[model samples]
Target: MESDMTAALIRPVAIKLDEVTKARVKRLAEARHRTSHWLMREAITQYVDREEKREAFRQDTLRAWDEYRSTGLHVRADEADAWLAELEQGKDIEPPPCHK
Candidate 1:
C-alpha cells in the first residue's frame, strides 16, 4: 500500500543537465554503487521533499493566523498559560498532517 502510494505520486521527467554536472553525478553514482538514474531520482526526491515541507509549513502558519484572528476576542488567559506551560515542559509536539 505504501509502495503504491509512492508510485502514484511519482512522475518521470527527462531533463538535460550541464556536461560537468552530468559527469559529477555519474562519478557520485559510481561511488555510491547506484545507477546515474537512481542518483538523479534520489536528488529529485530530496528537492521535492524540501519544497513540500516548506509549503506545508507556510499553510500551517497561515491557518494558525486565521484561527487566531477568529478566536482572539474569546481566547482565555488560562488557555494561553497552559499552552506555554506545555511548551516549557518539553513535551513532544506532533507534526502537521501530510496532505497530497
Candidate 2:
C-alpha cells in the first residue's frame, strides 16, 4: 500500500550520519525490530507534531493579545485562577465572561 503512493507524495531526504551515530541508529532500530528508515520517519513525525503545536500556541497567544489590546477587555489573573481551581475541585462552573 505504501508503494502505491505516488513519488510526489513522499519526498526522500539524504542524511549523512557520523559513523557512531549510524551504528547507534542501527542498534536501536534492531532492538525495536524496525529499520533505521522507520525510526527516522518516526522521529521526524514527532518533531513536526511538537513544533506545529508550539507554533499554533504562539499564533493563538499573539491573536489573543491583539484582541485584548483592540478591545481593552480582559480577564484578571485572579479570576482565571479561581475558575481553574473550581475545575480542579471538579465543580461544573462556567468560565467568567470577559469584560473591560
Candidate 3:
C-alpha cells in the first residue's frame, strides 16, 4: 500500500504565480488546513482534467462534422425536438437514430 502511494506521488515542476494568486492560494490552503503545494496540485489537477475533457469534446465534434460532410448522415431537428420533449415530460426515450 505504501508502495502504491509512492507510485501515485507527482513529480514537481517549477511554476511562478503573481503575488495576488499566491496570496489567494495561501489563504485557501490555510482555510482547508492544507499546504500551498497541495492546493496548487489540486488546482492543476482540476484544470488539466477540465481542459482535457474540452479537448476530447472538440476532437469528437470535428470527427462528427467530417462524418456528416462525407456521408450527409444526420438526425432531423424536429425528430430530435420531439424526442427531447418526451424526455422532458418524464418519459423514457431513446434518442432519434442518426440516418442518412
TM-score of 3: 0.82
lDDT of 2: 0.94
- The parts of candidate 1 lying over 4 Å away from their true place are 1-12, 73-100
The ten-residue window of minimal lDDT in model 1 covers 91-100
Error of 1 at 60 (Å): 0.6
Between candidates 1 and 3, the one scoring higher on lDDT is 3
Compared with the true structure, what per-residue lDDT tens digits does model 1 show for residues 2-88?
A: 999999998888999999999999999999999999999889889999999999999999997887677664446676667677778
Clashing pairs in 3: none
> What pairs collide in candidate 2?
none
- In terms of TM-score, which candidate is strongest? 2
